[model samples]
Target: MRGRSRGSGSFPPAINTKAWFIAAILAIGFSDSRSAMSIWKSAHGGVFSMAIRANGEFFQPPVQPICAQPTMWLAALSHPIVCLVRKLELLVALLVFVMAACFFIEMSIVKPPSKEVIRGLFVPSLSGPGATGDTIALLGALVMPHNLFLHSALVLSRNTPSSVKGIKDACRFFLFESGIALFVALTINICIVSVSGIICKNSAVVYGVALLACGTSSTITGTYAGQYVMQGFLDINVKQWLRNLMTRSIAIVPSLVVAIIGGSSGAGRLIIMASMILSFELPFALIPLLKFSSSSNKMGENKNSIYIIGFSWILGFIVIGINIYFLSSKLVGWILHNSLPIYANVLICIIVVPLMLLYISAVIYLTFRKDTVKFASRGELQMILSFELPFALIPLLKFSSSSNKMGENKNSIYIIGFSWILGFIVIGINIYFLSSKLVGWILHNSLPIYANVLICIIVVPLMLLYISAVIYLTFRKDTVKFASRGELQMILSFELPFALIPLLKFSSSSNKMGENKNSIYIIGFSWILGFIVIGINIYFLSSKLVGWILHNSLPIYANVLICIIVVPLMLLYISAVIYLTFRKDTVKFASRGELQMILSFELPFALIPLLKFSSSSNKMGENKNSIYIIGFSWILGFIVIGINIYFLSSKLVGWILHNSLPIYANVLICIIVVPLMLLYISAVIYLTFRKDTVKFASRGELQVPETDKSKVANDSDNVEHKDQLV
Candidate 1:
């Protein structure tokens, strides 16, 4: 059991040896574990990355800034002096810390924030902008999981008791000490944030010095961390000088690469990026620590109590979630703004996105991997039972109501009703929280207003559409898009317009009611109004389907599955629309506001017909649909349709290029979708170019009588002349 707890004790130290261990640590830890080291060498080398981020983005320049006039101390600190400082890392770190500490002391005496401001740093703050993302990112950095590695490595130096009781006593003291340490760390972080709240004249020099201290300190500590990881992971020791030299050399690689590729201005940008990468990998390290600490086999009687386990898991997940958020937001911005060619950006995504998914998969595996469970301490058992009430009720109620084993004597309506209501209230609260977070993101984001509205148009409605019936909104990924609920329900929306257009066309015709039919002016206005409605639908649909296919975060297979299912349905929908438009008979239609009902399906039918009917002289008299109406209607329809086609085509091409699908799958997709597309074009062309065979039966009118058409035109001319005379 103890052998399983740590691999270090099981291996012979001599077998691996110190040099081999150092080599391995350079390979593994510095791959990303030494991300903290990247900042150490890169930022301490440049003195820029430790300063504040403005508007949730890291802003160190691409090149290191050079001063026009150098200070005496700076001039003395040549490349050789810097190299010496890097070598004497501990001495340099302590010296910088002392200098910074002395400066802070002087600042405290000479110029300090008001007492209220100092007091506020310790207290909760609600005054931050609605953009809580950057705040969370900052907090996540301050209390990092990797920081635990540093602490854990340091803890090995202290004497820990072997007995379970003695360890329990030690844990009590550790908890108190940890709280104090965190409080101090948090205070310092807040102080830095507050100071960074405004930019000042001396920002470069003042913050530069502060940044230098931070980077040096991190580097010094990280050197110890590398040593600790080497010994623990490989059961070997290396000389301190050799370890430090190897670590520094490896860390300098990224810095040198950035300096060469991006030039001097982008020097410290590597450190900022490395720091973000560290955040991304932070949860992977934490998941293991949590699992091991929680496992009975590893910790035995000293294993975390249920409270500690629960609390630690929650905290760990929060950190993970923050990293995911940060990664997503940053990745999106980078891809959008990058100067690289589309294919290059795409190549980057193909490589990076899978690696990210793998990272997440690794974390999830570590977190949920089953471990041996044993009896909790008496106090832990009692505490668990006491707190179980709130969490227990929902499942208990669910099982009682749902289980068929209970027969007719199962949970009554009252119990079900209460449980459902309680559940809804809880869900509603969570939805509000989620919405607020999203709204805040959109509001604070760098996107334009139209883009923001586009996001809301896409996200808000889908959420509203699904949230009502979703059993578990946040807990599961597959809620709204089920086989029946998703596939068939999606089609039903398109089918509805099948009922509507006929009812409108037939009722509005003069043959159905010669005197009752709308006047020429009223009829003209109606076409224009419908044209706008169709235009809006086209806008909404393009934003939805295209954006969903291109930008959605769903797995690739899920997207491909959706494309496969929906392409066939869309073809069917187009065929139905073409048949309906030319079909002699009509069906009764139900009409209502689309915003209040299913819309995505209706968009295709609505968009297709608006061009055909409004431009056709046979539907309305030639006088009614003037050149303006025909031109506007056709322009809007074709524009929308063209945009949709372009987007879908581009997306398909991109997907085929980047998809994990095999060649056969790609060939199959192309075969299916391409033919369906050609068929749609044929249907549309046959609909558009086909001569009309059927007439309005009830109307008993073969096309508007020539005399009536001439009379309508004359009436419109007379009305226009009267308006001009007036």
Candidate 2:
């Protein structure tokens, strides 16, 4: 990670590299010695060691190296120079901002825009030649992909709260801060655009001064961004000064070349080209942020809400769509204008088309990639502690019990007995908790007797299989190897959605909880976690499915079977999970009212079922129901149902409009989809109005059936008396 040192011994290599780079630029810029010498002397205060002849040649220095002294002097000053540059970067940025403001104000005074300018800002329009190019440049300027990576890494420098509430509060604060910053930036941009529109004449001097200040500050920011990007993505740590130097040098060479060849206009064009490159690269950065922020695995309970997820995806697609359109139009225009030979055009298309496809395919892949990083949390830490504690307890207990393993070190009789008792108690509690949850789920499901029997039969074998696997893992020779544990955990974690989705559904369901319903905090947090898990699962599943379908060498029948069977089954499974997430809660306990109020707007589907169940006499028994709650729930349910219908219709309409289909095909789709949608709405309305049929005795009144009286009584005794069913 250490950079090239500035010591006298290390000086030659560094100096030579810089010297060669400068000489190469000079060779390109000036063929004559006098002109080159004059320029060199003007820039560097006449510090050249080699003598320049009248002709365009340099006299070779002696083997003793006359240039060594000045080169060494420059090398010694390099570190301090970089330190100064780093220190000045902030001041330069402030200056740039101030100067930009001043310029905008001056321009506004010189030539003001009308009210129509405001309207134009809100409403996008392309007019005249090069409008698309101008739009591309504007997008490139506003959204630098690398800046996102820089910001992501920069935020990590702050000490973020580990708790859910703290994380949420922090997110809000950041959002506010970002909003303010963006507002200021937007104002500045608007001012610039307005001024540019009003003033037809050039103001290069004013613009250049501001641009130079901006570039100087941006170089520093870019250096830091590059460093963080490397560290975050590649996990490569390098010295900051070295990174800055290398990056600046690389950037300088290209700019110098352009300046020498294309002059100021060429340099300006270079900036535009660079901006376009960044614009194209924007999706790579944006997609990952959207994916990670919205991911449950990476963000845990801090993942984005449904609204944020939807909004971000929409914005992302809009930007991507614009870029695609711009690129395609440009490509088409270029091809048409060039009037190349048919063979050459065909060759160009062959190369470019596949590359474009690859670019699109890559974007699609990135958009769907699962966030695999498992953010550490208190619960996860507790789980790890629980598992590890048993191992430690078992070892200690065995050692204390055995006189052979530790003769003199062995505990006294009472101590050994106490240790064994504690160990047993810990183990017992773990087993009881696990068994209770499993049994609860089995008992709570509204399945038929045959289904319950089948479940038990299947579970028994699976339980045995799990026990065998654990035993094998424990006894294996390589079990203690920890090097690949991270890789192993990542592989295992993909399967976690299976466990997580079910846990969320069951825990959040009052019908399944008997008398021990989850609190509002737990339910809310669990749902967020559940959504993230489901999203990641879908991302991974879809990616793998697509990949397999594309790459598989299976027969057409096998592929068709996969498409018809596996894909549909997966879709159905997902739909069932989603439905369960929205299903009823029988009890109206804890913070149900507060949760209903908070989530009713965003998650009407989940709240609707809960409302229906809680309002039902059969479900809530004799529990008092507030008239206000009942009324609000029904109103909210209807609104939600309406919103869902609207969303579905909009999507269907959007699909129909976007695709180039015949009139009959559009008619056919509308005919088929409209009826299905109506039926769905009808079913939802029916469910909302449906009355509960099952009646349960309140409190102590036992009204059990004859066949299950003993079993019911036994189960009731184990559970709370309030949880007893009639």
Model 1, 1-726: lDDT tens per residue?
Answer: 121123243223452253234334433343322333323333433354344333322233343222111111222332333544335444644645543563454345335566766677567565654333445535545555345555555444445666666567666666775786666556556555555445333343455455545554445555655555666556567766666566655655554455556643354444444444555556645665677677766567778899989998888888788777766776788899989999999999999899778767767765665653344687878655543333555556655665444557788889889877876676566577668989899979998899999889999887776564354432433223224556665555544556655655565666565467677787677656654654454455556877899998999999999889876765676567556556764443334443333453234456556666665566654444678876787677567656656766887899999999999999999999999767755665566566755544335544688899999999999997544322
List candidate 2 segments past 4 Å from native: 1-96, 105-120, 162-165, 191-206, 296-301, 368-384, 390-413, 420-726
Question: What is the C-alpha lDDT profile of model 2 across 227-281, one tens digit per residue?
Answer: 6555554346777667655554455555445545664355445656666666676
- Local accuracy by lDDT, each model: 0.56, 0.59
TM-score of each: 0.38, 0.45
Please estimate how well model 1 matches the true structure, expressed as its whole-model Cα lDDT. Answer: 0.56
TM-score of 2: 0.45
The root-mean-square deviation over C-alpha atoms between each candidate and the true structure, in angstroms, is 36.1, 38.1
- Give the CA lDDT, 0 to 100, for residue 634 in model 2: 78
Show pairs that collide, candidate 1: 62-265, 62-266, 63-264, 63-265, 63-266, 64-264
